[model samples]
Target: MATAPAANDNARPSRLGPFLRSPAFGLVLVALLAAAPAAAVLLGQPFWLTMATRVAIFALAALSLSFILGQGGLVSFGHAAPFGIGAYAVLILADLGFTDALVAFPVAFLAGALFSGVTGTVALRTRGVYFIMITLALAQMAFFTFTSLSAYGGDDGMTLWARSTVAGQKWLKNDLTFAYLAIGLLALFLVLGNRVLASRFGRVFRGLKENESRLAALGYDAYPVRLVAYALAGGVAAVAGALLANQTEFVSPAYMAWQRSGDLIVMVVLGGLGPLHGAIVGAAVVLVVEETLSHLTEHWKIIFGPLLILIVLLRGGLIARILGGRRG
Candidate 1:
């Protein structure tokens, strides 16, 4: 007792420290990324605005993946299933003459949730490499199933004749309107995800990731928590997909390809796992790099692949370099 150290010995630093070091850095990056499209619009560059729309859509998808893969330590390679389903949901609904965003978006989200809920229940039965393989297999099943559907574009994909109407308004068809919608929805999801991470459920899920046995020993069933996170992540990814279909005015089986899932994983790792918000940063970086490098060389992957390896090998990559987080 006499040797006990003062409780204040481990007191935290001033608020300004974390703010200046990591919080502010992250905020600045987000602002710049969000503002890029607006700047492009102001400059009369509609192409860049469309590009920004892609960035925002992927940002939302990556953000959702961060929840499960980043915080919950669930390496799900089947996330693309829900994403592609969301796109198809929108397409199918529109094909049925239900083109209203208000109706279509919820249906898309529910479709994603339904797919993830079923898949997660089974996928969570295994762990490590087995989990990864199972996820990949399930996703491929979806890919082939969609490919067999000759009614729609099937393997060739389909072009949307029109964007979703918002409350019967056709503004969603406008590029600028869609861009803002994507950006605004992304920001909302990011904020919502941040809140969830701070909640008790998030804490427990993270703890399960760190030591599932320990959490289970403490009387918490890890299955439901992981399942919920998995499903929620899928639903969110689906939202991104819906926006993507709106942005591109197209839907395809390609959206569910394993390659896309791998790309999502790359974004999570590239952004670093500490705050998870870095997922958006990673998406922007990946998209921008791909856009830039593709123009410079036809074999961009030959260049991009090694760069990704380098970042993952580095100490927590860009987020660590800028934000002072521990290496992953």
Candidate 2:
């Protein structure tokens, strides 16, 4: 009888291995970095630049969710709360004369962290569908709260006339420069997320994802670990939200709506969850498809809905195993 291969031989590489070994990932990153500058110089179109930046920003948000769903096994339906809160943080601070990027970014991050900690405390206590529903409900609360802030735009939504200034510089005011800055932030978060997945804390998070009971029995307090991971994910998502407000020069309760949260989840799953880079791919695919479909027909949703269903059914798992193999 033929002996089965050793378990180690069939095992997935450590999460970091894909980043270190995959030439394709490196090439894509380099291409994206190069494209930002090329688009500015060659195209000279503000519309294209803005669209690209938006893709990057949302990609960052999706990546944040991947950390929780892909690695930590926490399906937070309220992830958009931090994202919207981050956007609101920038706008609220901008309204109060805190237009500096340095100040706005930190404030946005803090808001996300605080929101996550409070929500995670309750949601984390439950598992499966209960956790999902509680998070969705909490996000709705945030949405309603934002709508009630009349001093801000309230239901009308607020428009930012200018992007935040960096230091004493007007650098971010330039569309191309701002796009580069957004890309840089995306790169930073992607690298940091990869590092986290390689650390001891990340190991525990992944363990919990695979088997919460096993991790708990192994003497690890799964709650605190998951909570920290959730908070970190929220903070990272907030960073994306902050950049988003800067990119669009606007803020609204729509940012925190349940639909936005659902879209974030779609991006994570579409990109092939767990691998940080997959989020970027998924975002690109979704945005490109949406734009294309919208141009072809006014009721794009009629076509887009079926397309998404088809993609999900054909793709099977979150990430396409046939194309990328399993995430490290």
Candidate 3:
């Protein structure tokens, strides 16, 4: 028995030999994951933690956009609609005395999925610029509808009196705990997204992105696959929106504004697209840059606007190349 145990332990090392050999890359990844949270905790700065939480939330939203734009080859300009809807869903639920995260989150996801299904059916009918325009229009419609809802605070936005509880516990009331929870969700979604993109369904989506007509000739229905992906992306974005609402303790039509949708796309592109992790990097970069630039000047847009153009022209392709070099 002792001899057998020694042999089994030796085999276990051999099984992991390849992974252990790639120590540098693994170590770097582990360090990167640990650095942000560790810094936040060590610094003991509430503002930095809040900013990091905001970045994670926005990154989750950008990741959702990447699923549709980068993978599904769907340029949806209305992505913010689901995000806003999810936020509003949480707000509404809180108002209705259902402030538990366990309840609010699932409800927000379902609402987003349902909205995506209905909106996708209409928006998917067109492709290219038409699709973009239609999505933008649909998002505008949603924004206007929200603006008219006087009961929910409408244009002025409603403040959330409290954050959602967890299983009758006020766990999320703490900013630090809530921030870690947001990070956990971001990591969870990223892993789930990676698995999804490697699955058989992901293969079909990639094929469709490469050539939809060829996929159809091969007896696959591209529309349904794309629609399902679109809905799933919307659902994920809605989850982010719910978190955002809880973080800010506010809900308003501005959440669904067209500029917000554009910002999401910008984050996706800046992060190099396709890879889920890129979204988080992009969000952090954009937010940090914006914060720094804003602090530097009251009219920072005067400087930031041209700088962004230069980045799009020069660094955009470089980012894509660095992040797997897959073009949409």
What tens digits encode model 1's per-residue C-alpha lDDT throughout 1-328? 0222232332344564376334445556567767878799899887798888888889888888888987887888877888899899899999999999999888888889888889888999888888889989999998898888888788998988799999999999778888888888887777787778779998999898777889999999999999998888899999999999888889999999999998898877777655666777778888989999999999999999998778766535754445433334
| Winner by lDDT | 1
Order the candidate numbers by lDDT, best to worst.
1, 2, 3
Which candidate, 1 or 2, has the higher lDDT?
1
Runs in model 3 deviating more than 4 A are: 1-34, 315-318
lDDT by residue (tens digit), candidate 3, 48-120 = 8888889889988998998888777788889999999999999999989999999999999999888998999
2 or 3: which has the higher TM-score? 2
lDDT for model 2 comes to 0.81
Give the alpha carbon lDDT tens digit for every residue of 1-328 in model 2. Answer: 1222232432355675565335358347636754965576687775677778878888889989988986676778888999999999999998999999899999899899889988999999998879989999999999999999999989978998688888968899888888888788888888888889889998998988777778788899999999999999889889899999988788999999998898888787777554677778777777877888999999999997887788765543434442243332
TM-score of 2: 0.89
lDDT of 3 at 36: 69
Top TM-score prediction, candidate number:
1
At residue 208, give the lDDT of candidate 1: 87
